[model samples]
Target: MRAHKITLAALVVAAGLSLTACQNDGDDTAATTDPSSVATTSPSAGGAGSDGSDAASPEASSGGKDTTAGAGTGEQSTSGKCRTDGLKITAIDNFIDGDPQGTVAVEMKNTSGRDCVIAGFAGVDLKTNEGTLSAERKGEPGDPYVLKNGKTIAFSVTYPLNETGGTGVRITNLVVTPPNETKSVTLPWPGKPSLPVTDGSGEPVRVGPIGSAGQGG
Candidate 1:
């Protein structure tokens, strides 16, 4: 009985020692593991921010520049072409002494307040008792003339004079059309009623291009 009691006490001490050794082995395994070695996810390049808003692009970051306004400052503004309503027309007798051709100077003054352009030949016609006779243009059309406010330009009409008082057309009025205009203005003939003869070209009247006031005839 005494021997059995001692053996039983020894068995209890060995079981307690084996349990302490197993607890120490578990503590060493937990201490050897590193926390930094755990896998984690990272944000992608140019991804959204933490607040869930998209990142700004290169164009949006820079302040937008205005490419339209005041871009045409280097260009000049040009005046419009002259119209008949803006002009005051008049006729003057421009015939010289002993000259075979009867010359009439038709003058136009720009009554409009703005500057205007007058280019090419003016259309001229002679109103007679028989009918309306249109004048033929002569020479090259010159450069455009700028007529300012209250400025004047003139053109001439030439025809063979009836010095012998032979059969001819009796003129009553002069009808004039400004350059680049479809409208017409009429003015009375400046002198006594006279007859005009047509030249070999069958052109009863000849009209010249627009020029300065005193350049006509």
Candidate 2:
């Protein structure tokens, strides 16, 4: 009877071991098949951030393009008359053979920072140290003369030549007024020369609609 009991106990122990092995295999299979047990990386990780950055880059580039398109890159228009304060005036003395009068060129340079226009003739007066000697305006009105900074335009002034018999009028000051302006600028007469004293019956001593430099006055 005792031998029979020992055999039965050994059989029970062997069955318990087999059952435990089956339960462990089932637990491993359940762990492998369960979705929560799986080790999975998030879908929106480093690669997803890179893709999002690339998409945003194109959007940023598109936004910059729109901004550029809204703003223009053309030169603004700066057309206007040259002011008297902005003009740098000079005189060029020249002579011609057989002419009864001496000719002088009045050069006007734009000293301002922008572009401007000067049209028609300039008003000129030949004055002495004592008082005004002769006043003339001989500029012919014409097209607008657009002048840029550092650009020059000139017109000619004719003055009666000094004669030996004391007929000449000595000029000390040259007062010049640009067109469309009431203000005037005074400059020294070329060489402080003299002009023939004449009555107001003859042609004007000043002649021009102002022209570009080196061109006909």
Candidate 3:
């Protein structure tokens, strides 16, 4: 009977040892694996964070919005200075026999930004195939012919056929300078002098660049 009791005690000790070993193994495994290590990826797109905000739409690259102010419409008159389009030659007329003496009419329009004057118009002449070799203005010679922007002004410059041998040859190389501002433009004439319309007229025809119209060109 004592032998049986010894066997039971031995078995009980072995069972206790086994239970303790199982608990120790469980704690060691838990320490090695970190529970706080969560995935940083987004749930919806599974996308990762980038250096900038959300991806830009295609429109952001192409056809982007323009924030700059547009150029003035032809309707608005200019102020302070003049632009190239300000002074233009609207019409060129030939009166076969308007006056007893044949006369050629050249019309000019002031489309200045503000009150402006014409300094001079010269160079090309319709009468002479070549540009006008000499040009002369009588009234306000080198004086500013003033105009409130937008109104068309006609100046009658009669070239007497009698004085110079000219028929079917009108006027050319006409330039006008303004008194108030220095900015001047080459008024568009019947034919373009340069080889190509795109080419710039040789020397800076000195009416003035806008800001300098009154003071410079």
Candidate 4:
């Protein structure tokens, strides 16, 4: 019986050693296979990737630059004096009734291709058959006149009627100069325009200030 007990005890010790070896192997496998040791990959910062989505994506790369920055806003803007080379000057004859005076409208039209601004009065004088009739400005100049292309502004010249013994002075030509202009334009007198008196005395023949076309005398 004792010999049988000794054999059983030896078998028990061998089984215990086998169990301990199994547990040690399990621990070694777990330590070697830690999650931190596993290699991981991420997208490249240089935009070098297989998907190409980092650079090729329209929405992601659209914030690079504005191609239309500092572009012009398609419209013309200007300010300065009106050029006389682009202006057309003429006279409008509307005879005044029942008086020794007559109304002559001196019209200025802007034939220029651009916009302009004109201010102050025009320099005017009458060329008479007898001699030149030096006249003076009548009223104060109006505000700054903004003249656009194909637009017209006007001023008036008043002189005496051509009645016998009434201003015997005969008008042959009308000379006009725009405000702030060195050049002058001469308009032919349609008919014989005369002043009430032969000698230049009182405001003989007066020229009014420049005004817009829509304004009346």
Clashes of each: 0, 0, 32, 3
Error of 3 at 161 (Å): 3.1
Candidate 2, which segments miss by more than 4 Å at Cα? 1-77, 199-204, 212-217
**Residue 9, candidate 2: alpha-carbon lDDT:** 100
TM-score, each model? 0.61, 0.57, 0.32, 0.58
The numbered model that scores best in lDDT is: 1
Against the correct fold, how does model 3 do in TM-score?
0.32
Q: Summarize candidate 3's per-residue lDDT along 26-113 as a digit string, tens digits.
A: 9987766554233322432334223223654456434344422233323322333434466665434343654533333444456555
Better of 3 and 4 by lDDT: 4
Q: Over the stretch 14-106, how does candidate 4's per-residue lDDT look in tens digits?
A: 999999999999999988777435522233444354466654667645544453342442222243677778788888785745655677888
What overall lDDT goes with each candidate model? 0.75, 0.72, 0.42, 0.72
Compose the digit string of candidate 2's lDDT tens values, residues 1-217. Answer: 9999999999999999999999999999898877553434444454654675654556566667557766663322346788999988888777767777778888888889888888877778777744775446554566776787778888777766766567366788788888888899888788427665567655446656677224422
Sorted on TM-score, best first, the list reads 1, 4, 2, 3
**Local error of candidate 1 at residue 4 (angstroms):** 75
What is the model-wide C-alpha lDDT for candidate 4? 0.72
Cα deviation of 46 in candidate 1 (Å)?
20
